[model samples]
Target: MRNYLTLFLLLFTLQLSAQNHVFVETESFEDKGGWVIDQQSFVVMGSSYLMAHGMGRAVKDASTTIKFTKKGKYHIWVRTKDWAPFPKGPGKFQVSIDGNPLKQVFGESGSDEWKWYDAGEVDIKTETIKLSMKDLTGFNGRCDAILFTDVPKFTPPNKLEELSAFRKKLLNLPDSPVAAGHFDMVIVGGGVAGTCAAVSASRMGLRVALIQDRPVLGGNNSSEIRVHLMGDVDKNYYPKLGRIVREMDNGDPGNGNPDAKEYGDARKTSIVKAEKNISLFLNTYVYKVEKQNDIITAVVGRDIITNKETRFEGSFFADCTGDGTIGYLAGAEFRMGRESKAETGESLAADKADNFTLGTSNLWASLPRDTVTTFPETPWALQFSDEYHIDNTKADWEWETGFGNFNTITDAEKIRDHNLRAIYGNWSYLKNHKSQKYAKQELAWVAYIGGKRESRRIIGDHILNQMDIQEGKQYPDGSVTATWTIDLHFPDAKNSKYFEGQEFFAGTKHIKVAPYTIPYRCLYSKNIQNLFVAGRNISTTHVAFGSTRVMRTCGMMGEVVGFAAYLTTKYKTTPRGVYQDHLPELMSILKGETIEAQP
Candidate 1:
């Protein structure tokens, strides 16, 4: 009998080794279920998925628990989506091993790729081994595939594999008794646009608060990506962008050669030190938008450090959330990608239907070549060419990947993974593995600050189309301005899937538009009355967005929305009312404090 029992236990142990006893697989709470839906995407491969929503997880909690006899080494790993690393996650949740809080195994503050976590085990003092969630402060997160297997039976870490980098996940924010009950205005995004909005509004005698996810000021320019700010400031002569610009690179950090790569990241401290009235919420994300009777009554902000969730109530709100999360939540109208050519009649428009991942570009530099560095080559993407009629060097501050082949949802992981793989592969060639331009080179900078080109666009009163941009159409209610040439990155830019029998692809181009006016109607929500949108997500046809998607115009859009909110409240009127009667007032706020309008 004893021999038979031993054999049975041995068989059970072998089965456990074969299966990891999968438990949870979901997205970071940062997405708030929007990314999982059609509005956004979480495209990845080789994993189970669940949609996380409503302060609850999508996956069923596990009823099965593993019982351990002796205390030994163990681990817990959470699968990740690809796009998480691009925008990174937000929200402060926790991981616990045997009821003990895991310091910072995972959180929504930063981005990570698919990997297992080394969750050191605890002593088995009780009858059963218990693993559970702890420090689950704030709200948002999903665990679709929750597995409880012996930690020793996990896969070895792959070098090329991308894992999320987070120091710690504080589950809540610091306690604050809600900053009064209301304010004149609340600005989201804290980048150049948000800062300008706050400074200008505050100077206009309005109480304002600027919320930002990063600890520093200047959104993309905040020492993160090291990209430069090129807009209607020095080029068009605006005091608002000029004052902020002088504080940053009085000369030109993004100009020159070696210096060009590090300009955006260097301007972080400059904007913060320059703006005073802007009560900056560094590292705080506006996760939820509360609406009461058609107006956004409060903007719910979560602080990952102190684990605090505060309701920032205001008479008005400006969405610079970048992804347009605030506007989407507030019932704003928005669209993503291009329509079929049959619908728009443009040659550049798509012919078929599919999810598009307007991917990010992570550029690299090898300075003062002396030593050789080896890298892997990407079998998929090809070298830059002119036949495709695209600028090979234009992808400087903003390098893009993953537009042609990858799906935007479920395959987002694959999209981001493929992008990173291609980038490193190309870098290897530059290093010594493969060579497109150099003989022998050195490594200068691997841009940690990734420029994410597209995701969500907020729907507004007017959806700007390709024709309007081409004609340089003007509106009586025009408030903000856009200046990038009508740039359209087609469905196939680098991948060969679009054009058959091709290994490389040159990017597509569209007719350019000189600087043009963007109407004020493009800021407020088409569905929700008081909700406003700023940033890349505003209503623009995929063709028109190619040009207006630039952050410069997005900032100006934020400024316009902020001022509009002020006037809307002052007169107790609709955005249209503020626009029609307040034309001179609106331009007075945005017009040539320095330079010329769009010709």
Candidate 2:
């Protein structure tokens, strides 16, 4: 009887194993080839996917090795979206198993939403198989994940929640995240603001963890995006406030420079790595936060490629993500877009509150070559005639998008794609239509990462406004000085006449103002006790943000926040407590005075 029972159990286990499925995340591929991991839409798409950003030329194949338990027929499903669905999508690619290319072409389903497409079935004779994706158009083809299952008539989940659960179940991920480490401060961004904060806090004898989603730091000023640091760092209310920011500046490379080294990616990385008290975690995205009442207890981040989740606990946290991602997750009070003139009492404020805000730019540049260069016709890109096309070799901040038509955080991928179409179409016309003028010009660099201007402004005790700058309002908690003009951007009227709703060009008018200092109260969240916000997301009206949003000014905000953080740790109080109770100590630290805590 015992022998018979054992035989039945063995058969049941085999059947279960045979029906199992294999899931492969494209971002986790060992060899990604020319494909790049894009996490801009991760919030809406559920995960980071691989994108072939070849700029019109087909990229090298992205391949990985997969193993199967038994040799049999399996069905395949690929998660992808046709980024440009109208007039046929340009991003088309094919999947291959063991060296045999599949018949189904991906990224052409005419659907804007991300969904799984069935790729039929294939016979597997070997346990080890080579899986790969071949880009056909090189117009930003994307693949999220691939699934192979032995169970017949099986379909993968399409909804975000269901898909997330399915992935976890299939990947066998832990229910709880692994503890990263306890820290005095956990900074959620690696931009200039966050980098300065980490450096300042670390130098002040606090253990810091700087988490950045991308491989490199400097945010928009990095080589990936290539925007130069602007605003005045040398002229400050507190002379010592922008010292750290000045140390990281790599001279003005100008926006959309072709050379990557001019952006100083290595210099920024080394600066953070040199800090002994700072533990830098690159390529980590923070998606969730743990909160107790109004205070954030911890933040949960996942490895963009490996998908491993980590819990970072800290006594205090800083929201320097520019998008205010940490503050949003922690339920901190925040505002997006513009405010009404009646509400804010500012002259620059709109008559009524709406979704209008500064746009995002994906700058591109071309260089003169020794020989004539040719570019392919982009039929799938935004069509432009000689009468209505931009006639420039390099695109500066003028090549912008997502002013009122899209959300900077949710529709980031769409905005980026629109910018690409505009860029390619314009360049094609310049190269092919009017070859004489731009015959020797070759496309040098195009930013796949969009340089954003504004997003969610996490509300603090004080919301800086336009009058405060024009009037030069003084506060006892004056910190970082703002010297840049209130430069606000709007869609170019000429481009609007041609592109209408999808205008890609931008125009800005600079409103000059005397140098003014931002209050320290504007650095910490009003609701969330332990939260500190810097960068463009700090408490500010849309007009005030125009000046404060610049990288140099934002970096100084980080320096002030860092000093305030030290006061919090020394006094064992919240950010507000430090502002109300220990303002003198924070002011002293900002003035270059040393105030060590008693042991």
Candidate 3:
């Protein structure tokens, strides 16, 4: 009897394993149509998903092809979230199998945790079928993944590790990584500095790979984020360094989706594409790095649209990612927020070290219409007191938040969402309240991309402090000239009275200082050999960073690093080696001299 029971159990297990199951990643759909690929969340169901940001108008349907084997009753499950679980959410969506709509709808049903919702079983008759997600509300409805299974025992995995493994097996991912080709230098960021670095390096006859996480170049300056290019470029030191920036700048002010040319999005793309030696990979986000000892071997990036992974191998690498994402993954030491007065004897340093870095901004603008406009009441969103209500038509750099204990990188989704709620809530109050100031105004645009001011400071060979900027302390190896004053942003005291440690508006305080040059030593990782850095993440005390964090200064830094990277490839030397033994060689490049003719 025991032997018979064992045989029956073994057969049952095999049957379950052989049951038909189909897992479809919504973001991997061939024709995403009008849906936006939302990979911003570190806290997501899978790697990333698609969002229907129709803003109340139904977006075009996103559809994909699927093949089914066992033509029987198959249970359908979808992974999604109801953004506002407390009150009735605005977003709602439904899935259709083989042109047949599911009985139950999704998006408005689940909570913050992305769990599977049973969308009722369907009888399968054909081997091939079309699956699509139809949006009901023009609001931000999202879809992560869809699962269809014949076996009753099969359940979708919720744990990340288990889900990842399941996805790999189901998707038939290769055991080996995909090679994305070799390069002399790989600059990961695509912001002002990273873009300049790639251009400079490519122009100097070096093979370069420029990876940007967004669809367009210019991190904050891009129309998606809409921050204008600030600080002076080509004024001091290497005049040729800012040439690329000049070509790319469209000179349009204010932030919105008025037109593509306003932010020079097309112009930047054209310039980068024109470079013979530069391979521009837009919409690719780097998540991992492989290192041997202190040398970085390769970086791994995922295609935001296709959900494909690629390994980017390079002889030299640059951490131009504003958040120091690359450096952090490769185990590089970094600092966050203000330092203690005892650590650095700067007058601006706080008495105690605290995690209080500069805040991120979500700027919004309102367009005045001839006829009166009404905004939907967002009672579920954050509320403001009558006295503190800002009856304004636009929000700019000062409209910032995310100081306090919020981890900029990890808690990014929450921060951006808060800004969205704030924008909607503020507009609703303005239009509906007894105050008739904004009755004729309509929200033209609100940024989905949060423009961050500060984050991780990757430690380099030289840690520039407040005195370095204030005293104009010159380093023999200084390469990039930083002209901005010792400027710092803090939560507005008036705004803080309401939010307290979570103020969304910021106030700037500046002290004029003579322009000082930033040392090349501050542009490379201290321990991570062969890894260079630029932009806001470069080694600097919180006080010093205040002056050096502007986009143009970052561009100059990138230009310097790009030249140094060429030297590294030519001489086959590490970043430290270039600094100690070949300091003049780097200076020669900054001085706009030929590499071979340098003394």
Candidate 4:
């Protein structure tokens, strides 16, 4: 009986090993076609999903080929969401296997929360099968992942922890870190700021690693989020600071509302690739930071597509990540939202400290055509009162939300959903209403990636405030020059009356300030010795952030940080050491690169 039991146990283990579990991430498909990858939401079921955003019409089928070990009956589960579950949702799609459409269609009925919906069983006779998603309504149907398994009662894990383990097992990922080589400086986040920092540092003979969470290098400037470059560059004190920024500029003065051709997503990429000392890693999100007392030692980045983790070790680390992700993970001192009047003594400061930061935007643009286009009605959305009739077809920077006391980092997905719902609902009213103002308009594009303005600001040796810009205070260590107005955005009181807590429109109150210099002390962390920061996440008061948050201004800050980092490497010292002991050397480098901007 013991021998029989041992044989039975061995057979069961073999059966389990033989069972093939194939998981295909739709976003990983090489030929995405009309399906756009939605990655704005940080905490998602998996990395991200492919979204079919055909406005109102049905979209082209997103198809891929999957090879199986053997042909047999397979249990299929698709990860999808209804998006609007108040009633029968508009977003719907059907999965086709081996050119045969499944009996069960997905995206029409499911929880708004992402979950694995059983796509019913499919009988596969061939070793290879073609998988396709046919869109029924192009309102915004999405698919995160698809699973096919022959194991009995096999179900894809729904909980995040279980799903993570399942992914690791299925991908055969290494338990230990994969070495990504060593670098002098590792710059996280690849917006205008991070890109410039990488380029500048590489030019100065420092081995640099430029890591971006998204597939593209430009964060907000990329076509995914679509915000045009703002603020004046190559001016004020640091004339040549924006030379790298100019190389990647879209060139057109127009925002993302204009033709897609204007935004040079490829131009920025070419600039980075030309730098010999810079190693650029796109579609790699840094989730973990390894730190020694007061210093970050390494950061672990996971590949968005392959589910592989790589450890990047560097002498110096820059938190160019606009959200201050690395700093937060390293337990660096940081602040978010508004500050009390006593905190910074700015005229516009709040009476008390509160959680109110500039909102994020999921902007939309519309093209006018001679023929009429149809947009579906989204009655389930947060309705705008009849008093507010939105006749405009295009949504720009003003279309913002998430200001109502919420953590923009943790609640990113919810914020994005609110923006989407507002866009769809407002469009529905404009198109279906008796008014014919938008009769010939069609939405060309809408951003699924949220264009954020503010988040955690890492505390540094010096925190710039409204008084700094307003008084034009000059510092001995001043590096970058900011020339934009103190433009602060708040929830529009008029819109709030109609939508209540979920106001979408934001109004900007601008206070023009003279072009002022930002100090070197504002660039590096106070607590974390080797940490440096740039972009909007740099240490600054809320009112001061209004002026420095613009892209071009942030780009200049990056240029200075890049120079400072090079000095740190050359002198074998920390960021603060470069400022105190090597200020003259740093200033000499800045003086050599001085070239005036064109009038």
Query: Which candidate should be chosen as best, given TM-score against the real structure?
Result: 2
* Model 4 bad stretches (over 4 Å): 1-19, 44-46, 384-386, 593-599
Cα lDDT tens digits, model 2, 362-431, are: 9999999999988988887898996888899898888999888999999999999999999999999999
Clashing pairs in 4: none
| Superposed Cα deviation of residue 146, candidate 1 (Å) | 14
Kindly report which residue pairs in candidate 3 clash with one another. 56-138, 57-138
Error of 1 at 256 (Å): 12
lDDT of each: 0.52, 0.90, 0.81, 0.83
Q: Write the per-residue lDDT of candidate 3 for residues 1-599, one digit (tens) a residue.
A: 66765574566446547877788988888788778877776434447788887644578999999987668889888988887554656678888887788887777663766777877788888888899998887567788889898878567777675576566556767756689899999999999899999988887778999999889999888888888877777567665566766776778586554444678788788889998899999888898899898889999887777667789999999999999989999999999989999999999998999988887888878777888877677665667667877767788788887876577777776677667767767777787883467778777777777888899999999999988888888889988877888778988898888878657878988888777889989999999998899999999999899999988888888888888887887788988888888888778777777665212
TM-score of each: 0.64, 0.96, 0.92, 0.92
Candidate 2 regions exceeding 4 Å error are 1-18, 597-599
Candidate 1 structure quality by residue, lDDT tens digits, 1-599: 66764574565447545643333323223222231211113112222233322211122222224455444444555543222333443223445545566565444534455444444444445546544443232112333233344546554222221111010111112344355347767878776666666665665556777887666666555444455565554443233433433444434456223454355444444454455545657666665678876678888765533334567887777777666767766766666566777877656567864455366554545555565444333332333333432322223633455464543433443443344444444544444423444445444444433455666777777878777766778777755656777665644533555334322222556466776777777777776766667767777766667777765666666666666666766677766667667767666656544322210
**What's the lDDT for residue 14 in model 2?**
64
Model 3: which ten-residue window has the lowest total lDDT?
Answer: 590-599
Model 3 clash count equals 2
Candidate 3, residue 139: lDDT: 66
